[model samples]
Structures are given as structure tokens and as C-alpha cells.
Target: MRLATFEHLGLRRSGIVDLGGDGDDGAVLSPFPEGTDLLEVIRTGHVPATGAALPLAEVRLLPPVEPPSVRDFVTFEEHVEGVRRSVDGTAGVPDAWYDAPTFYFANPCAMVGAHDDVPVPPGCHALDFELEVAAVVGREGRDLSPERARDHIFGYTIFNDWSARDLQSREMQVGLGPCKGKDGATTLGPWLVTADELEPYRDADGLLRLALTAEVNGVEIGRDLLSNMSWTFEELVAYASRGARVRPGDVLGSGTCGNGGCLAELWGRRGDQDPPALRPGDTVTLTVEGIGTVSNTIVPGTTPVPIPSARKRPRARP
Candidate 1:
């Protein structure tokens, strides 16, 4: 089932996409609560039905989760090769990097929904896009073997790991990481397709042959096949949860895939060189074969409200 958590007419609910019959008949069918995203719904096992089954068109699609916990891994070899080739002459996996899987936490708060305008932060001259697949964890587990990892997955969704190339390059050289460089913008979903629906495509390699593509303002920019991933999802899950428990709703993102996954990989584009790095009017769309497309717009950044300073509290009463 293509499940979604959405708000329509001020009412929030979770439901399976009833893409049956006419294309215009799409509806969100369950009534849960505001925070009822796909991961939460699946963990319960009881799919709740909604009122009036709000037609999908009128409702605004929010990020699959208002606040999503994201854990990203660089599992595709081709992507690594492409990036290495771009950054330097270095190519192929360094033995130590392959000895065990490694991961990084992308921003949880940067999550934006389909059609939402992703902000291109001020002074960031070079911005790029990454096309990826994400696995949503359904049940919490620790030391889960490869055989059991798939069972813990709830579903799959698309992820766009937007980057500030210049910031990332400078930060990585210091060996600290692309902390502020990466925390800028990351996006997910028009909807989250459940594991049951994606099961047929899942293989021993856990690689699905999906045609993935990216376009800027309707112009084709990048394309690749999901089958090109070097490491399988099961391997990543096992490696990630070796000792720590991966809880339900914790997202694992398949880092950027090969070819045009990012500007740095596609072209030698980096900061200052590109005059217009994703302005307010630009739009980006990423599409995976089985799942639908997710499109987002670029917008000017707004200063987030500052948290008021806390007042010194009076002495507490005995």
C-alpha cells in the first residue's frame, strides 16, 4: 500500500493511497491523529479508516513526517567512485571504508514535503541535489542479522540531500564533516510506499531495478538505475544495527546514486563558480520508477524566530 500521513481542511490523518479506478479518485483513507505518519501507522498493525476519505488533490502534502529522524549511509559504490573522481584522482573503495559500513546523520529538521519551497540559504553560491532511496524502520531491533533486517523495514521513499558544495569541501578537509554544510536542506516524499508493495522488487541483493531521474525546471539533468547500487540494503541495515537498536520510524537513507546524483559529480560545479545556485524560482523533481515523483520549489530564506532568553527563576519554595 502507498501510505501517507497528511492534513486536509485542518484535519490530519494517515491512510493508504487508494489509487484505484480513475486517477482523480485518489484518497487518503484513515483517520488517526496529527502526528500519525507512515512509520507510526505500520507499527500499530491496525489500519484505521478515515472520514469522507479526503480526495488527495485538495490537501497540502506535508513532509511524510513533520520531524523525521534521518540516518544516511553511503552504500552505492558507483556513487562513491563518481564523487571520488570529482573531488580528486582517488577512486575505488579504501579498504578500511569497506571493512565496515559507515553512516552520517543528515538533518531531521530540514525535512520538506512535496511542493514545498526548499530554501537556498543566503551566501551559499553552490547548491546541488542528490537522488536517493530511504528505508523507514518499522520495529526497533538490536544486532539484527541480515536475515531479519528486511523484516524490520516499514517502507521506501525518495530523498533529496541538497548540499552546499563549497561548505562541504572545506569542512571535510578538516576531517570534522559537512556539518553545517549539509544541514541546510533535505527533502522526502509525496508518499511512503509500504514494504509489502515494494516486496516484489526487493531481492537478495535488496536492489530494485527502478528508473530514477532528476530534472531542473522540467529539463532533464540526471538519470540512473536503482540496480546500480553496490551494497545491498540488507547489508547496510545489518552493519548499521550491529549493536545499537534501530527503532521504528528511524529512517535509513541510501546515499546519492551514480551519474547526475549531485552537481559536483555531474559537473565540476562548486561555489562561486555558479552564479545562480538554486534561486527562489527554480524547481527540482526526482522520480523513482515504481513510486511517484516528488517536486519541490526553491524559495528565499526567512529568519527563524529566535528563542527568547530564559528569565532567571525565583528561588523555589521549600
Candidate 2:
């Protein structure tokens, strides 16, 4: 079943999307209640259709859940290698990357809906988008083993990790961040597809053999198979849960895919003449085979607030 949150009749509600309903564009059914918290529904695991079904076209979709936390992992070796080459002129991935699934915490408060407008962050020129898949945690777990991690996942959603590449490059030079470079905006939606709905696409090896693709304006930029990940979602979740608790509504991203997931990777491979960075008015759309698509348009950013610059302090005598 696909779960979603949408605005209908000037009120926010949670419901199940019925793609084959009597309406011309299907309908949204099983609405929990007006102002219902979707995250709480995921925790209880009970979704009842107590309200009337609304025509899908009449409702504006929102991010399915307001995730409490988001952990995005770099699980694709090709992506890592390409990005490293672009940033460091190196073609090989770090040895540590192969040892474990490395990740970074993203700002949940910065999330936007599937079709919302994303602003190009202030002081950023090299804007980019990462095509990724994210799993939403349904059950709470701590120090989980990879084998037992699958049960904790509730559903999947397409993730667009919007980036400010120029800012990212400058910040990482000091060895510690992608913070402001990435926190500007992140996209999560279309809807959340329950894990069981995707069982048909799951291979015997436990990899979800879903096809993923990205496009800008109307041209296809990159495509890849979800099976190409170096590590599984289970492993990523286990790693995230190590010594910490993963609760319902927490999100775990499958990172950027290879074969052109982002413009940075494309730039690294073909140089700057080809695919250009995202600009205001450009639209980015990402499609995951079974889960669906999330598209957002770029808009101009707000002017930044002025701040005092830091200065060096004199050394004290020992």
C-alpha cells in the first residue's frame, strides 16, 4: 500500500493512495483523520479508512512523513570514485569506504514535497541534485544486526539530496563539512511505498532490483540499477543503529547512484562543457521504478544575513 499526506479542503490529512479508483485520477482513501500525524500512524501500524475518499487531483501531496532524523549513506562505489576524482583528482575510493557504509546526517527540517520549488542556496552557484532512494524506519531498534534490520523498515521513497557543490567543495577542504552546502533543501515524496509492495522486485540476494533515473528540464541525465549499491539497506540501517536508537519516521538514504547520478559525477567524467549545474527555473525529476517520481523546480534564494567575520587571536605566553 502507498501511504501519503496531502492537503484537502484546506486541511492536512493522511491516507492511502488508490490508483485505480472510480475518479479520473484515482483517489486517496483510508484517511486517518484531519491533522493526523503520519509518523504516529507508522508507529502503531494501523491505518483505517474512517473518512471519505477524496479525488487525488483535488489534493496537493506533501512529504509523506516528517522524518525525525535522516542519515544519508554513500553506498555506491562508482559515485564515490567519481566524486573523489572530481574533487581530489583520484580515481580510487578510500579504503575506509569499502570497510563500512559511510554516511552523514541531513537536516530533516529542510525537507520539501515532491513538486515543490527549491531555492538555490545563497552564495551558491554550482547547484546539483543527488538521485537516491530512502527507507523509512517503522520500528524502534538499537544496536541492530544487519540480518534483523529489514523488519524495522516500513517503506521506501525517492530522495533528492539537493546540493551546493561549490560550497561543498570549499567546506570539505577544511576536512569537516557538507553542512551548509547540503542543508538548504532536500526532497522526499510522491508517496511512501510499503516494503511488502516491492517484494516482487526483490532479487534472491535481497537487493531491490529497481531502476532509477534522473532528468533535468526534460533531458535524461543519469540512470542506474538499485542493485548496484555496494552495501544493502539492512547494512546501512544496522550501521546507523550501532549504539544508537533508530525510531519510526527515521530515514536512511541509499546515497547517489552511479552512471550519472549527479552533475558533479558527470562533470568529473565529461568535464564542464557537457551537463551544466542546475540554475533557477530548472526542474529536476528523479524516478525510482516501483516507488514513483519526485520533481522540483529551482528558484532564487533569499539574500543572506550579514555576520561578523572571525579574526585571529594573539598567542599567550606559556
Candidate 3:
């Protein structure tokens, strides 16, 4: 089912979306049981099948699920190769990456629904967006094997890992993270499609075969098949669960797909001639087959908020 969380008159509700009609705005929804929210559905591993249809256009779309914790995993080989190649011409996929999936914790508070304006975080001059697919964790488990990891996933949704390439490049030199470079805004919805809805797309090996794409102002920038990912969501979940617990409402993302998911990669590949950094009023849209498209427009800050920098100080002894 195509499920969504929406708001109307200051109330947030979870529901099933009915896209059977004629027009774009003709979308309609049927709410879940009263007082039930998305987080509750994920926790219970079940979403009721019946609710009255209400026009989808009449409500405000919220993130499909407001996760308790979010973890993004880099599993696409092409994307990893592109970023690595940007850093050095001879670099190939990281060898260690083949042995295990790598992941990081992200700020869920920074998320906004699809169509929401992505405010230029103060000081972010080179803002960019990453097109990704996220897996929502369900139930609870620890030390889960790859064969069982898929069972813990409740659903999937498009993830836009909004980025500040300039800040990311500078801070990553310290080797701890993409920290403040990221953390500002990450977009996560139009709606969430349950795992069962995607069962037909899953291959014999357990990898999903959805085709994914991203565009800026209606111009396509990138595209890739989700099946091309070197590691599957199951492996990512298993790896993430080693010595740790995977709980309900935790999100795991399939990091940026093929090339052009972000400007940093584009600039690294094409140099100074690449497209300009995101300015106010630009819209970025990402689409994944079997899921949906998410579009967010950029809005610049009124005043510049450059990141503070530090300089070396001379020692008295010297």
C-alpha cells in the first residue's frame, strides 16, 4: 500500500493513498485507525487495510514516518566509485567496502516532507542533494543474519540527503565525519510504500531492482538501477546489527546512486565547468520506481552565515 502521514488543521494522521483517479490533484487518502500514527504502525508490523477515501490534495504531506533514529548506508558501487574517482583518478571501489557495508547516524529532526522548501542553511554556499532510497526498520533484532534482515524492514521511501559540499569537503579532512557538512536538512517523503508492495521487484538474490533518477528543475541529472548496489539492504541491516540492535522506526538509506547525485561529484568529474552551486529558488526532484518522486525547492537565507574558520597560532618558544 502507498501509505502517508499528512496534516490538516494542526492534526497529523497516517493513511493509505488512493491514486486511482484522473488528475495530479485527484489523489485521495484513507486514514488509519484513530489515534494511530506511522511510528505505531511500524512498531506493530501491521497497517489496517480499510479507511474512508479523502482527497489526497486536501492535506499537507508529512514525512511518511518520523523515525526515532536514522542510519544512512553507502551501498551503491557506482556512487562510491564516482566520489572516490573524484578524489583521485586511479581510485576504484574501496576494498574494505566490499567486505562490509559502511554507515553513519544522521539527524532526523532536519527532515521535511516532499515539496517543502529546503532553506539554505546559514553558511552553506555549495548546497546539493543526494537521491537515495531508505528502508524503514520494523520490530527489533540484534545479530541478525543477512538471510533474516529483510524481515525486519517495514517499508521504503525516497531519501534526499541534502548536502553542503563545501562544508563537507573541509570538515571531512579531519577524518571524523561529514558532520556539520550534513546535519542541516534531509528530505524523506512523498509517501512510503510498504515492503509487500515491492515484493514483485525483489530479485532472487534479495536485491531490489527499482530504477532511480534525480533531476534539477525538470532536467535529469542521474539515473541507476537499485539492483546495481554492491551490497543489499539485508547485508546492510545485518552489518548494522552486529553488536547492536535494530529497532522499529530506524531508517537505513541506500546512499547516492550512480553519477550526478550531488554537485561535488559532478565538479570533481567535470572540474570548474560543472553547473553552479544551488542558489535560491531552484527545485530538485528525485524518482524511484515502485516508490515515488520527491521534489524540494531551494530558498536562500536572507543574510550570509559563513562557517567560522580557525588559523594556526605561533608558539612563544618558536
Candidate 4:
């Protein structure tokens, strides 16, 4: 079943989406009460589709859930190799990356809906979009083994980790995770597909073989398979739960796919001549097979506030 949080007649509500025969002319069946928190419903694990059904086209889709926390992992070897140069001026994947799934905490409050407008961060020029998938945690668990991680996942959704490459590169120089460059915005919507719904797409090795694609302003820019990840979602989740906890409403992203997932990777591989950076008015769309598409239009950002640098202080006697 596909669950969604949408707005209709100026009221935000949670419902179940029915994608008809062609997967376009669908309807939303309201199960929970109006103004109900979708994250709470996911945590309670009870969804009853017994209310009125409204045309999907008539309502505006919102981010399925307001996640408590978001951890984005880089498990795509090809993607790591492609963007290393642009990120840290390196040409190869670091050895430490192979030892475990590396991830960074993203600001959950910065999430936007599928069709929302994303503003390029102030002082940013090289805005990029990352085509990826995200797993939504449903059950609480700590120090879980890889084999038991799947049971804790509630569903999956398309994730677009919008980035400011120029800003990211500068921050990475200090050997720390990205901050303002990434906190600007992250897209997560269309709808959430239950974990069981994707069982058919799982390969023999238990890895999802979903196809992912990204486009900029109606032009195709990136394409890759989810099965190409160096570490499976279970492994990523398991690694994440190591000495920590993963609770309901927490999101875990699969990072960016390889072979044109972002313009930074393209620039690193094909030179900075083609695949231009994102600008205001340009729309970025990411689609994942068996899930759905989430697109956002770029908009101008507010001017950054000025901050004074620290001044040197005289040494004090011990």
C-alpha cells in the first residue's frame, strides 16, 4: 500500500494513494482523521483505509513524513569515485570508505515536499541534485544485525539530496561533514511504498534492483540501478544502529547513484565543459522504479547574513 500526506481544500491530511491502471489517474483514500500526524500513524502501525477517497490530482502531495532524523550513507563505490575529485580534490576512493558504510547527519527540518520550490543557497553557484532512494525506519532497534534490519523498515521513498557543490567542496577542505551547502533543502515525497510492496523487486541476493533516473528541466542527466550499491540497505541500517538507535520516522538514504547522479560527478569525469550547474527556474526530477518521482523547481535564495571573523586575543599568564 502507498501512504501519503497531502493537502486538499486547504487542509493537510494523511491518506492512501490508489495509482490506477496506468499509474496516473489515482485517488487518495483517507484512513486517518484530518490533521493527524502521519509519523504517529507509522509508529502505531495501524492504517485503516475506510474514509472518503479523493482524486489524487485534486490534492497537493507533501513529504510523507517529517522524519525525526536523517542519515545519508555513501555506499555507491562508483559514485564515491566520481565525485571525490570535486569534493576533496582527490582522484580515488579513500580506503576507509571500504571498511564501513560512511554517513552524515542531515537536517530533518529542511525537508520539502515533492513539488515544492527549492532555493539555491545564498552564495552558491554549483547547485546539484542527487538521485537516490531512502528507507524509512518503523520499529525501534539498537545494535541490530544486518539480517534483522529489514524487519525494522517501514517503507521506501525517492530522496533528492540537493547540494551546493561549490560550498560543499570548501567545507570538505576542513575535513568535516557538509553543513550549509546541504542543509538548504532535501526532497522526499510523492508517496511512501510499504516494504512488502517491493519484495517482488528484490534480487536473489536480497538487494533491491530498482532502476533510478534523474532529469534536469525535462532532459535526462543520470541513470543507475539501486542494486549497484557496495553495501545493501540492511547493511547500511545495521551499521547505522551500531552502538546507537534507529527509531520510527527516522530516514536512511542510499546516497547518490553512480554514472551521472550529480553534476559534480559529471564535471569530475567529463570535465567542466558540459552538464551545467542548476539555476533558478530549473526543475530537478528524480524517479525510482516501484516508488515514484519527486520534482522541485529551483528558486532564488535570500542574501546571507554577515558575520565578523574572530579577533586574536593577547596571551594570559598561567
Query: Going through the candidates in order, what is the number of backbone clashes in each?
Result: 1, 1, 1, 0
lDDT of 4 by residue, 1-318 (tens): 899998888888888888877667654455467667789878989885458778787888889999999999998988898888777768989999999999999999998999999998988988999998999999999999989998989999999899999889888777788988898898998889999999999998778999999999999999999999888888888998999999999999999999988888888887672688999999998889999888899999988888787788797788
Q: Which prediction has the highest lDDT against the true structure? A: 4
Whole-model lDDT, model 2: 0.88
Candidate 1: lDDT of 131?
91
TM-scores, in order shown?
A: 0.85, 0.95, 0.91, 0.96
Model 1 residue 70 CA deviation in Å: 1.3
Residue-by-residue lDDT tens digits, candidate 2, 159-243: 9999888888878887775878898988999899999999899887788999999999989999999999988888889999999
Candidate 2: C-alpha RMSD to true structure equals: 1.8
How well does candidate 1 score on lDDT at residue 178? Answer: 74
Clashing pairs in 3: 28-56
Off by over 4 Å in 3: 21-23, 48-51, 85-90, 302-318
- CA displacement after TM-score superposition, residue 136 of candidate 2 (Å): 0.5
lDDT of each: 0.73, 0.88, 0.82, 0.88
Q: What is the lDDT of candidate 3?
A: 0.82
Give stretches of model 4 more than 4 Å off. Answer: 27-31, 315-318
What is candidate 1's CA lDDT for residue 247? 75
Candidate 3 displacement at residue 48 in angstroms: 4.3
Error of 1 at 16 (Å): 2.0
Candidate 2 regions exceeding 4 Å error are 21-24, 27-30
- Give candidate 3's TM-score: 0.91
